[model samples]
Target: MNSAIESLTLDVPDTAAAQAFYDEAFGLGDRLRFTTTDAHSAGFRGFTLSIVVAQPANVHAFVDAAVTAGATVIKPVAKSLWGVGSTLQAPDGTIWKVATTAKKDTAPPSRTVEEIILLLGAADVTASKAFYVDRGIPVAKSFGRSYVQFETGPASIGLGLYRHASLAKDAGVAASGSGSHRLVVNGALGTAVDPDGFAWAPAEVRAGA
Candidate 1:
């Protein structure tokens, strides 16, 4: 009974605005959904949603669309030893990262996203890793106590954990925040909060997802 993520529900002040921005920026379709909420969240929300693409061209396309659609640039697109990527903050205060390991264009440019990853910033990576493992989520990849990726299936949203401050730094944000996480992960893990305060709910089936 391994657990897997189905979809992510974001709590925003205005669902209409979020829907518009998401549609224009990433066109994520049903992989992401939204709900209206006035929950008080400030600074980093202890997590980031990442769009992993096929190449640098796609990375630029998504980041450009996000910026044009009113997302604030947290980290401009740049190349590193690992890959090229950028970080942005959506109008709803959610952090997003667009990245790819292929630094050069392999084929015609397209905005097709390869995967959606939800990375939780855990205070104790090892402990948080154990918590999810106890819930029947198998580890896909791990780097000692620094990071852990779970086997959430190819169709489901990817899940991972990283050191709290390191995750914030990767997203180009300060590691200080309070109030609700403003995110709910719908998955087979049932309803519960992780060690880093990420909430989870029962998975719900949606058309075309």
Candidate 2:
């Protein structure tokens, strides 16, 4: 399947507030849709939005900006075994993990955040993998019973799964019960919803003149 996570659709208490935060902090600009109306009434848990960067400076810059944008600072930016890192809770309640891996070459037009990986916490990783596989989303990598990363293009935006309890612990939040996700994946699995409630919708086709 030619699938990629184009942007995240989060259910925020205030759309304008959420959009302003993302735009100011990460330069996401119009890449995020924060809506006050919709299925946002359901509380979200069981997932994380990861921002992987190539440099420690980028990580620090992002964390600093997020704080200035009024995000709840969950963990202050610091060097950990993983790399320079930090955590924040968006005004809308989405947990964001900002960190850096080994340094790599990055050209101009560079942004503070590099790649966005949406990791869903599943009750059963195997079952989740099978569900997507049946839908034609290829597996790029998998580790026995622990994790699975779906095949996506070089754009670096993709989907994956992990054990629910384990993921919740790692994110410093309690395991959440199943509910709707503020996410949407675009590609071959047009207009479908996963077992976990994540949506895979087709891109809108506009009329020609």
Candidate 3:
């Protein structure tokens, strides 16, 4: 009844071998709660998994106990990083992992968000790159066939091809041509014009030549 879900870990593949390893490494004795299945194999599921070779007689007893506790064993127990795991859905509708833990390694997926790239989708990348270069910005990389990235002091700007139809679809605005983007740099309101005749530069431009 506690709020947190304690991970139910399982051992996989060779139970005796994995148990031996754990016994030596972590000193886990009698912690191996053997669940029986009707088949000659004990499957892993719900936070962990394992592929267990039964004593050939207690399979049905294990399967019945699990089912009575609202555990659904959905497939053949197979070997994995823990031993063998079988897919089982918990009573709460959450797909719980039931795997047999062995000596093999397992790595989860992960990543880091460094920065956000502003996709300034454009029509002409070559000309656009030239425009940014003239404006005191350095080119980082060309986004292959459709866009390019320019270095922004602490951030990065992406230049993408601007298609009128696609842009209209994207913004859900009635777009005949490119729209205006207002920018506030160092306390001044600036405007930039594209294919459309929109007011886009600040009245007072920056102080450097």
Give TM-scores for every candidate, taking all chains together and pairing residue i with residue i: 0.95, 0.85, 0.28
Higher-lDDT candidate of 2 and 3: 2
Please give the TM-score that candidate 3 achieves against the real structure. 0.28
Assess candidate 3 and give its lDDT: 0.34
Worst lDDT run of 10 residues, candidate 2, spans: 102-111
True-vs-predicted CA distance for residue 83, candidate 3, Å: 30
Instruction: Compose the digit string of candidate 2's lDDT tens values, residues 33-142.
Output: 66554653343477888888877777777888888898888777777676777778887788898888744335432345677788988878998899888977789899
Candidate lDDT (C-alpha), each: 0.91, 0.73, 0.34
- Alpha carbon deviation, residue 85, candidate 1 (Å): 0.5
Alpha-carbon shift of residue 177 in model 3 (angstroms): 5.7
Q: Using lDDT as the measure, name the better of candidate 1 and candidate 2.
A: 1
Please, what are the lDDT tens digits per residue for candidate 1 over residues 175-196?
9999899999999888998887
Where is model 2 more than 4 Å wrong at Cα? 1-3, 38-44, 103-111, 177-179, 206-209
The candidate with the higher TM-score, 1 or 3, is 1
State which candidate has the highest TM-score. 1
Candidate 3 structure quality by residue, lDDT tens digits, 39-87:
2212111111221322212223333344555556664345644354444
Clashes per model (N, Cα, C within 3 A): 0, 0, 44
Q: Compare the candidates by lDDT and give the number of the best one.
A: 1
